[model samples]
Target chain A: MLNKVVIFGVGLIGGSFARSLRKAGAVREIVGVGRSATSMARAKELGIIDAIGVSGAAADGALPLADALHGADLVLLAAPVAQTEAILASIAPHLQAGTVVTDAGSTKSDVVASARRALGSKVAQFVPGHPIAGRETNGPDAAIDNLYVGKKVVLTALAENSETDVERVAAAWRACDAIIHRLTPEEHDKVFAAVSHLPHLLAYALVDDIARKPHADLLFQYAASGFRDFTRIAGSSPEMWRDISLANQPALLAELDAYMAQLTVLRAQLAANDGAGLEQVYSNAQHARHQWITAIEAAETPPSPDKAD
Target chain B: MLNKVVIFGVGLIGGSFARSLRKAGAVREIVGVGRSATSMARAKELGIIDAIGVSGAAADGALPLADALHGADLVLLAAPVAQTEAILASIAPHLQAGTVVTDAGSTKSDVVASARRALGSKVAQFVPGHPIAGRETNGPDAAIDNLYVGKKVVLTALAENSETDVERVAAAWRACDAIIHRLTPEEHDKVFAAVSHLPHLLAYALVDDIARKPHADLLFQYAASGFRDFTRIAGSSPEMWRDISLANQPALLAELDAYMAQLTVLRAQLAANDGAGLEQVYSNAQHARHQWITAIEAAETPPSPDKAD
Candidate 1:
């Protein structure tokens, strides 16, 4: 029954959140807060929000940072990770007494700590979240109206975040067509380091490695769809990935060390010309990939639909 | 027009060559020799060859070794690298004098040396060739008639392979719908190590690394298309990849070392929390990727079609 939701930094994630809310008929009014005139204009043009709430150049452009929160029941801090803490700091005093504050930042422990410090007694209403859906493409333009149509959204709750607060966060995500999952902030950072952050790091590193070769131009000539696919995430926003990587460095470095250990084993097998061992490893990896594919397919299918088919 | 062509070890590559020839209308007859009746039968069933020259089952459903050379005016060695030297030894005595003998082995310099030692003066017609196209799926059943279409085929020749012999190899590939690219055997190995072989190794390693994570099951749930694309090559036949990795070890190891250097810089950047530095590296990689995409697109566009528009 949250009638008014205020979204800070209405770029891709924020704009998509707006779309999902509109599509699901969850929030009656969406107030977007941003400094960029172009982004604000584009959000309005795309009908990503009912009207620009605060900082609006026009009556509907945007509300002032403080005014944007007046009477709002929910707040989404969907800004980039580097800005999340600062934005939370700016709006803390203005936030209504009981408004549930949540976020979509990639890393969470720091964000949660910052939210706790900034919101004080109101920390019980703050939840941190991340939706594991995005493209190499970025910004509001790249935001598909249905981006979260069937994706997983993780909400990390502190002990101070009451059951009521967590439920509200889950309900907001559900309205966006996202299936909600809960994880501890530490667990969220570690898992994402393995999956999201590490993968992008490897992609950027591999692409950069190949680009340095003397015959890099010709080598890329022979590169096919497989290479393209492996490195596609290398095209993701560097600044954003850079922030995410540093924010989650401890887990990422640990993951990298583990990866190098595996690579060392593979390298030794190749050096020894151990095709049998190589075959065993590759076969197992391939088998695991197929199993992973099957698991994803199973997860995507609803329980009844899965059995019915 | 070369009406008759002999293909040795006609599994996926050989079967594909047969079909590519049939579709291009370049060669009049294709003589296929393989170890498995299943493979030969399936190749024939798929219209890959007008006739199977020799067929019998080996341990893994591969064709019998010796019969692969019968009546091939231009014999193509498509045997596994381990078997290439032995296959050449058997074929050398029976190969018709003045017949152009070439190979489709992935690693070339070793095979070329073996061909010379086996056939002596008759090595003039022997050209080493490797077509850089394949799928994760393998055997005759996985062979696509158009697999080589719009793909690059590298030809590595020794001084003994006369211009006429090289031209004939080039002509055969042209007829098979391959874009011909020439390189020294050493050059071929190094370039593919950076672009092809290294990527495969990384793909296998990354999948293994991620698989070791606790929530590995859920980790993949967040894997978007980019992850799937990056790891597609990981699904390749372990046996084949193992052989390729081993046969091309020196070059691959060298490329791996180079890749590790790039990774080190990236890791340092992450550890140092240098967001802008990371962004620059990512942006450079992105630029390089775009350049590659543009080159590929230009190569794929038919020259006359643009004017026809």
Candidate 2:
């Protein structure tokens, strides 16, 4: 059992993790940490965490960094990607010798590097992770115990990480009913950049283009369910996405180039009025999407038992 | 009251229109026409129409073209964009003088041109329209009376179109509880290219690109709800979208260029690791989407009374 777990950035991801661990009875206490005392208090009031703490400095019944980590067995860094380094630095001196550290950042390479810089020798205990589950709504109020029940938790364990520590972090997630998958930081970043990061950027750009047009209101008025679904991700938190885009810049740029090439070919076909070419492209896409939906639905039907490392 | 209505395509759009008009008691009889006799029979059996007719050649108890339009007071051409010209030619000789003809083609300019070529002087009775409403599902089985309720129906009336013909078509759409909006054919193509056509193309292209990747299945396995929503339009009818992309080639190409420009600028920001620039774009999109959702929710709160011409 985890004696004490401290979660930094106590919003959706961190708070939900706390609730999940509590429901699993895997942890004795979850100490919520954040910059906002009001929000942390709300998290505590909502029973998302057993206590509250402030990351930078203590205030409003919050424990200081060293005190909060005095007896902690695990540290979950769930802050914005841009703040990962700073958060790691703040808590590095306070972490116990055998404590395990993991993160819920969307991008993993940068977070792993941050851990190496901040924790030095103790970085061996850091097993960088990303929980692939979320909703558009955020904050402690959006936290729920079942958020990760059937979701995938990707762990990019560095060469420096001990097998024991990796297994410890995996066990924590498994207890919360998350299926764990392993990948190198590079592979994880490249895969997610193509699938997740690129789509979010395209959604944001499309919505921004329409929003800035002279006929913005009229365009939105005539925009139907397709437009609504296509731009739904544009409604996500800008700061979070901005941090992720910058954090995974190289992989994201490669994805953007690939997407642009595909779009360029499509534009040429449209300009040439190539009906056969257009149909081939759309037909291939529809076929692939229909297949993927079938596969995904099947995968979701029965959650695989806790995966072996 | 309309004496008789004939729908040439008899699928989602045409079948839904017939059902709505029947529910409103606005027409005495509805004739369903299509290439598939079985589908037309199903539409009739489902009560979407009172009779069935076949396009191309008559068979399997299908009525001939002349017989289908024998007394059609209003003819709705809901065929695919590629078939607009041929459908118009088939019905031209059968249409009585002053009989109103309208089309549900996605691209207005091409349909208008087809009317000019096929109908000759009868082009004056043709009113080109596009109802901005549909589900991914098609066929008569998917038709619903409420599909067009609160939807926007854009009409692009050619100079040859008489004012009386325009009012007649608008009244028919209003009877189905659709709000009527008028625009020049050029304007309609440009607006729809930006808001609808480009998004569909991007979705199709993105899905195809991912499907061609080495880790396509893995990428899809981890794809979340955002991916689902963004790619929903990619599941649309390929032949229909292919026709639309080619029919509105010039305008679609222009919109594609504009979108490429926007994406290019965003790519530059990512390459430069400009967090502020990325944040600015995402923030603008999120704000615009939130505003549009609010406006749309308010607009959908109450169905505006049947619009006056």
Candidate 3:
């Protein structure tokens, strides 16, 4: 069992990891560190973390982080991707030898790059991971011990990292009953840009489009289940999505170009009243969606009862 | 206290109307007319209809339409919108003098125009309607007595329609527990094109884009809950959406153009790394979406445990 674990940003992601590790008997104590003092106190009260460590990090921090990081078995950076670099920089000076570090950021390449820039020679201690689980809810109160259960935890191993460090990170996630997958950081960013990041941008665009219309109120009155589901992701944190969109800009832009091309073709068909063409496109989508949903159902892994993590 | 009701194309919309009418003790006998003999037979077996009537409309129809229309109090055309003109034409010669006609089409202006062309002077008896109910599930088996409970049903009364005929159509839906809203055919088309048609087109475009990519299988494998909800509408009937898209082409095209413009601005912001602009758009979307969801929840009108109807 890990003697102590240090978690930065004890929101849903960090708190859940602390709770899951405790549930699995893999960690004996968890100390939380984050910008939100209220949430860290809540995390401690709920036993999600054993103590509140630091308000921030390093020379400018509210408290000394070394007291918490001295012998910590692992340090998890679960903050927004925008903070990854600074958090890594802050904790790098205090990390004990053999203390593994990993992150649960959505964009892998950016986080890997942040680790490299912050840790310098100690970057080998960082094992980059993206835990694909339910992030539909937030706050310390929303954290659940089973957040990563049956979820896919992707580990994008760096060449500088030893195999033992990677295995230790994978084993900790496995303790929470997670299945592990490996991908290069570049591949992870591209794949997620297509599926996750692009959708958020599209959803945000659609919502903003309607919200700004003169008849928006009237139109919203008639919007139903379909619109609700389509724009659900638009309700995500704007800053978080903004960071992700920029962090994965190249891949995301390529995705946007591809999607815009599809929409342009579809618009041409509609403008020409080409029923056959529209039906063909719709048919392909329906068939593919049916096949995908069927495979998902067959796997018996119901989508997280939650969204985007 | 209608003695008989004749329904054309008795699928979920027609079947639900028939069931709801019976549940409210508003109709005594129901006759179903459709191209699918199997489905019509199933409708009869399920008691969603009292009898199977004609197979199709006019001279090419499989059975006599006279018997079903002779004493009918109302005629509801619930088939795909593409069949609207033909269905109205066929029923015109046989409809009883006081028999009210209505439809459950997605697009209204096109249906209103079809009514005027087919029914001529008798168009006064044709009160066009669009039932906004749960259509996620289809066919007779999926019909529920409360399918329209607490839902909004839009009635687009034509200038030629008599006040009594319009009221009768509204009353029929009221009996099925739907709230009634009135709009001109043009207004209905424009509003729905924004809320419904545009989202379906967006969803289909997204799915088709991803499904056609070389790494599509890999991308889909990692797709989670957010992707699933965003593309759920892509699972709808291609024929229905194609017809809706064509029927409301002008308004839908306008909506599409507006969306494309929004996307262009978003792309420029991303290209320029304008974090402030990106966050502003995302914030607007999130605020609107949250407000919309909160209002919807406050109203306590749960989305049709079903989708698109």
Candidate 4:
């Protein structure tokens, strides 16, 4: 069991991770750290953390980090992507040798770079990780012990990271019932940029475009369940998404270009009134989507022991 | 009450309309028509219609139009976009002089054009209508009596349509508890193209793009609920959407261009690492979506009679 764990962002992800670990009996004392004292205190009251550490804007490393880091076995940086580097630097001096550091940031390459810059030689203990799980809700109140159950936790271990440190981080996630997969920071960034970040950006853009229309109220009135589902991600946390967009810019821009090319071809077909061409594109998408859904359902279904034999 | 109502297509929209009318006791007799005899027969068996008329491929007007059209007070052309004109033309030769004709086609301008071409002088009796309601599931089996209840039915009344004909169609939808709204065909097309059609096309394109990736299965495995909701429309009927994309090309292209412009600006912000700019866009979208949802909920909430007084 971990002696003590410090989570430097007591939001939904961090709080959920703490809850999961508590349930798994994987950690002893859990300390929640954040800029908001009220929220951190509330998190403590909600049993999301064993104690609360309010780290106010003292950038000189005088925020009683020693107490929080004393005998700490793990440090989870679950702050916004933009704040990861600062948090890393602040805690680098206090973390004991062999203490594993990890993060739940959406984008990885930037976070990995931040760990390298902030920790220097201590980066050997840093294993950048992202759990592909979240709800539209926020804060400690939204935390649940089972949020990471059956979820995917992607680890982009730095070249400097020791195998033991990486394994420790992976073990923590597995304790939370999350399956761990490793990839290069670049590969993780690219894959999520296409599947997650780009889709969120597109959703935000679509909703913004529609909201700006002259007849927006009328348009929205006619907007059915389809529009509701399509723009659901537009309701996500703006600050979090903003940090992610900037952090993974190159990969996101490349994916946007690829997507724009697809839209352009569709536009050409529509413009030419090419019914057959339109049918072909729509048919291909429909068939592919059906196949993907089928594959997902099949994977989700457990194989019977009889069938296995 | 209508003496006789003949509905072509007999799919989700058509079948739902027939079921709604039956539930409302608004029609004396409802005749279902379709290309598939089995489906039409099933629709009849399911009580979605009083009788089934299998319109065999004998486009030579040999499909006993007289019997189906005999004493018909109303006719609903609910076929696919491409088939609307043919269905309108086939029934035009037999529709009684005072018979009111309406449709549930998605694109109004195209359907209005079809009515004009098919009905000639009888176009005055045609009132193009589009009920803004549906489920992803299609066919008579998916029909629900309350599908149109509290839904908006947009009527793009043609220039040739008499006020009486328009009112007749409005009354029919009102009986099904649908609220009727009027718009010019051009305005209707533009609004829907922006809010509905463009989103559907983008969704399809995004899903198709990801499915073509070499690591598509991996990508999909990591895709969360957000991706599922965002790409839900990609699973829509290909033939139906193909027709809509082609039918509303000009408006759809315009909306697509506007959406592309928004995406391009966002891309520039990401490339420039303009966190503030990205935050502004995302914040605006999130706030707008929240407000829209609030407005929709408020609108859906029944007003107190005391407040009305």
Q: What are the DockQ scores of the candidates, in order?
A: 0.65, 0.82, 0.83, 0.77
Q: Could you give candidate 3's per-residue lDDT for residues B263-301 as a string of tens digits?
A: 999999999999999999999999998998989997986
Q: Pick the candidate with the highest lDDT.
A: 3
lDDT of all predictions: 0.78, 0.88, 0.89, 0.86
TM for every model, in the order presented, reads 0.92, 0.95, 0.94, 0.95
Q: What share of the true interface contacts does candidate 3 keep?
A: 0.90
TM-score of chain A of 4: 0.93
Candidate 2 residues lying further than 4 Å off, grouped into runs, are A55-61, A302-309, B54-62, B302-309
- The best-first sequence of candidates by TM-score reads 2, 4, 3, 1
Ranking by lDDT: 3, 2, 4, 1
Q: What docking grade applies to model 4?
A: medium
Candidate 3 residue-wise lDDT at A118: 96
How do the residues A1-309 of candidate 1 rate in per-residue lDDT, one tens digit apiece? 678888877887888888878778888888877667678778778777655655324454356666778788888987778887677777777878768888999898878878877777778878889887775555677666688888889988888878988898899889878899888998888888876778788888888777876778778877777788778788787777878888888888888778877878887887788878778778877888888878877877778955675
Model 1 interface CAPRI class: medium
Give lDDT tens digits, candidate 4, residues A1-309: 888889988888999999999999999889888887778878988998887654544343323677777788899988777788898888878778957889998888888878889989888888889998975777889889999998999999888878888988899999999999988899999999988999999999998888888888877877878888999999998988987888898999999999988888888888888888888778888898888788878878999888896
For residues A188-280, write the lDDT of model 3, one tens digit per residue.
Answer: 999999999999999999999999999899999999999999998998989989999999998999999999988899989998989999999
List interface RMSDs for the candidates, in order. Answer: 1.4, 0.7, 0.5, 1.0
Question: Model 2 over residues A1-309: C-alpha lDDT tens digits?
Answer: 899999987787888899999999999988988877888889999998888877676776788888888888889988777788898888888888878889999998888888889989888878899999975667889888889998999999999888999998999999889999999999999999988999999999999998898988878877878999999999999998998898899999999999999999988888777889899999999999999888888877776677534
